[model samples]
Target: MNGVDPLGTGVPGPREARARARAGTAGPTAGWAPGHAQANLIAVPADWAYDVLLFCTRNPKPCPVLDVTDAGSWTTSLAPGADLRTDIPGYRVWEDGRLVAEPADATPHWRTDLVSFLIGCSFTFEGALDAAGVPLRHVEQGRNVSMYVTDRACRPAGRLHGPMVVSMRPVPARLVPMARRISGLLPAVHGAPVHAGDPAALGIRDLDRPDFGDPVVAEPGDVPVFWACGVTPQAAVMASRPPFAITHAPGRMLVTDVRDEEYRLTL
Candidate 1:
């Protein structure tokens, strides 16, 4: 089944072909699609694209951008044949800083004035952590990574600004340095731990509560290690109160053709 146009005619481009092939598939293709890249998706107005792109450039720790699409173009040449409109399993639409809806596909909301930005996700670093034998609680429990909005302000770029959001993974105090070493190798996916000991230092006052995703047991002798999360852009978009914005729901990343290792070298 090819991608049917709004008019009901089947489109025959490379994107259409891949969309037809990978349709209805869901979840992180991690371990399955070995060496394939996974991206974080942020779709906002074309007018905001440049400012947001600059925000990404300035705050590379949280918004490591992988690619940007021309206004209204859903096909990403950087991640060939992947259709941004429907490739991802879930999407969240925000209006006036509130979540309006979450849909499995965003084609219905696609607009010529809309532009897509693909950011790097920390999921790219999971392979490295697993390779080093750092057990991730969320992955073991089949839950999403826990995310918190910190009082730490991101360096503002134009109107794109907000508190930094960090993803927490509880590590044995002994393995904290190992985890940092493994994750630091991929800077594009948010390198190193922004906060390793007390969440209070980063203004994260609660450990049981998270602004996004599921919370996990820190366990005795386990220290919560935090990394600047890709979700930081979503927080910024909400704070900016853009007329319209779209982002992948937490854990539902935009899987790309770029490999995880590619991020290790200069991005």
Candidate 2:
């Protein structure tokens, strides 16, 4: 519970190191640590962690778990000394399926009964897309990834069950297959597109209105491609109304000790 602040009060020593380790800061060590593994964050009651872990296990495409914290433990041993309470840039608190607050740190609300889950994110695949000459409109426009709750029901586990949430990226008709191929290699991070061509087929009523993130132009000759999203877990957690739940804000993730290449072989 007593760890140094990352905001530069002084040269970080052991306590600071423990704090940094718990925070899961990886990438760009000059200002922040680089090449360190980054992961998605989910905080739930210890009672719920078991079901959620089972949910993630059943639905690996959408909820690929990277690490889990022991009940009452804040240090991220899986990712090396990262703190789950304060490492991320932001946190979202949900009550009964609605977001109540976005806090900079979860320390004030941290509970001994709480446990943390680190999931894989599609951001891990952005570099691969750029390398393959696919353009990500949201990244280019400085917007959050557009996500939607789909008609598709994820394989239910225990109390966790809900429509799959997906992130959209418009690809040129000619390059849609290539984009799928590149992403298909990384199944732990949502794998390949679940649906391509018609958004209505997935029960997405409007392309202009998204459940999360900014709407991007599909453009001429572009097709809307969807990937199972980490947000699916958040949505399920919210609907289950587990008394208390915490998750990373959109676009914020737990940078980790694992590498993106690890995902390519996880399946």
* Most accurate candidate by lDDT: 1
Q: Kindly list the per-residue Cα lDDT of model 1 for residues 35-57, writing each as its tens digit.
A: 45567889889888888998998
lDDT of 2 by residue, 165-259 (tens): 89898888899889999889988777788889899999999988999777887678888999888888888976676778888876566665566
Q: lDDT (CA) for every model shown?
A: 0.77, 0.74
Model 2 segments beyond 4 Å from truth?
Answer: 1-37
RMSD vs true structure, all candidates: 7.0, 6.6
Alpha-carbon TM-score of each model against the true structure: 0.87, 0.83
**Alpha-carbon lDDT of model 2:** 0.74
Superposed by TM-score, candidate 1 places the C-alpha of residue 13 at a distance from the truth, in angstroms, of 22
User: In candidate 1, where is summed lDDT lowest over 10 consecutive residues?
Assistant: 1-10
